[model samples]
Target: MPDTAGLAVRTLTPDAPAEAPPVLLVHGFGSDGAGDWIDTGVAAALTAAGRTVIIPDLRGHGASPAPESAAEATAPALAADLLAAADAAGAATFDIAGYSLGARVAWAVAAAAPDRVERSVLGGLSPVEPFTAVDIEALHRAVREGAQCPDPFTAAIAGMVSAHGDRAPGLALCVEGLRDTPFAGGAWDAKVLPVFVVGENDELTRGIDGLAGSLGARLVTVPGAHHEVLGGPHFRDTVLDVLAR
Candidate 1:
């Protein structure tokens, strides 16, 4: 596919006639499109069901170029990149399934371009922005100076970032950008109704019920933790069923 907005997209064509609008699968933080969806068989399942799948490596992740500054990695910016990917894929409107940080970006996209999104499945998401509580200085120190984070949450995030190896700096910038534009589910005014899915054991999504109620949407809880849910068959099946409707 053509490179628009500097995002590297993996487009999968179905074996049979297309059964639905192009499905965009957005991966979570520190994970690329292939790692989150392709390797997990989510994209394959959707494609086998005759849906054109578009997976984009968000800025600062995978093969996509990292953002020069945190400003370039904001939700709106990432949403714009996804839109550009859709345009390149020849999809005027599409269904979206996003996990974790990707879910937040899906929210921004639906809010900004409601007419372009046919439906959305937000997995591993919450009304509360986890980045807001992140200690930015401590995170930066941990990434740059190999210092330990004092805060438990920050330490957790630092560990996730470190797992990405040299991508730690870019991911850290993304964290800062996300913190700057914290998610407020009450403020969401998208016309499209989204199905919210959270892992039953996910403490990070404590306020998901309130967020789903505010949107007049259904919340489906699967058996797993935050990261585990994304790779589970339950989460994949839930997304496929929701988008099929």
Candidate 2:
């Protein structure tokens, strides 16, 4: 079923035991749940653990509609979309986890419906909002005008958008929509079952301990960089152990 925002979603279940607290997995910017979770073996691991996983391709990515308007990509809007996915899956309560942009959005979800989210794992994210300093214009220039942009990071982001095929323009719009919105520590409710996970070498690691202190969550650091952390055993084990406990 399509969400209120008409985003595409999928629910994968293990064959042996179909009844388990559902786990909703959200992907990072310019990436879908399948690519970020399924292909990475995270989803498979969850399913093997008898978890029913609901994966939504956030708006402007994967099978979801790429809205031309940037406003459709706001964190609150994406958060609601995840809730809608839960509703569609008939999940009154579920565990949620996300990485990068997805982690930011998951924080929004926990804030929006503290009662619904049983536990959450925020991975590859930091206390400080990652995209606050990003230059959307420079990203657009690199992809649209083929201009020589100074920031390699921004340029690489633009390249990722372009590699996403037809969603390029929409992804760019989403990036612009997310520009003014940074992850606010206040959005993390202390009552929520939240865990903060990040790569040991990730630049985002700064101030994470402070944020975790505020959220009353344990901060777990694994060995790897921001992107590589997701594919490693430590990160995956940390999440699974949290959920298992």
Best by TM-score: 1
The worst-scoring run of ten residues by lDDT in candidate 2 lies at 184-193
lDDT of 2: 0.82
Off by over 4 Å in 2: 1-4, 150-153
Provide TM-scores for the models. Answer: 0.94, 0.90
The backbone clash count of each candidate, in order, is 0, 0
lDDT of 2 at 203: 85
Which residue pairs of candidate 2 clash?
none
**1-245, model 2: which lDDT tens digit per residue?**
44445878878998765555799999988889888998889988988888989999999999998866767777887898889989988898999889998998998888788888887899977677656666888877766777766887777778888887677888987887777667777755525558889888898667888878875679998998887888888878887888773
Q: How close is candidate 2 to the true structure, as a TM-score?
A: 0.90
- On lDDT, the candidate that comes out on top is 1
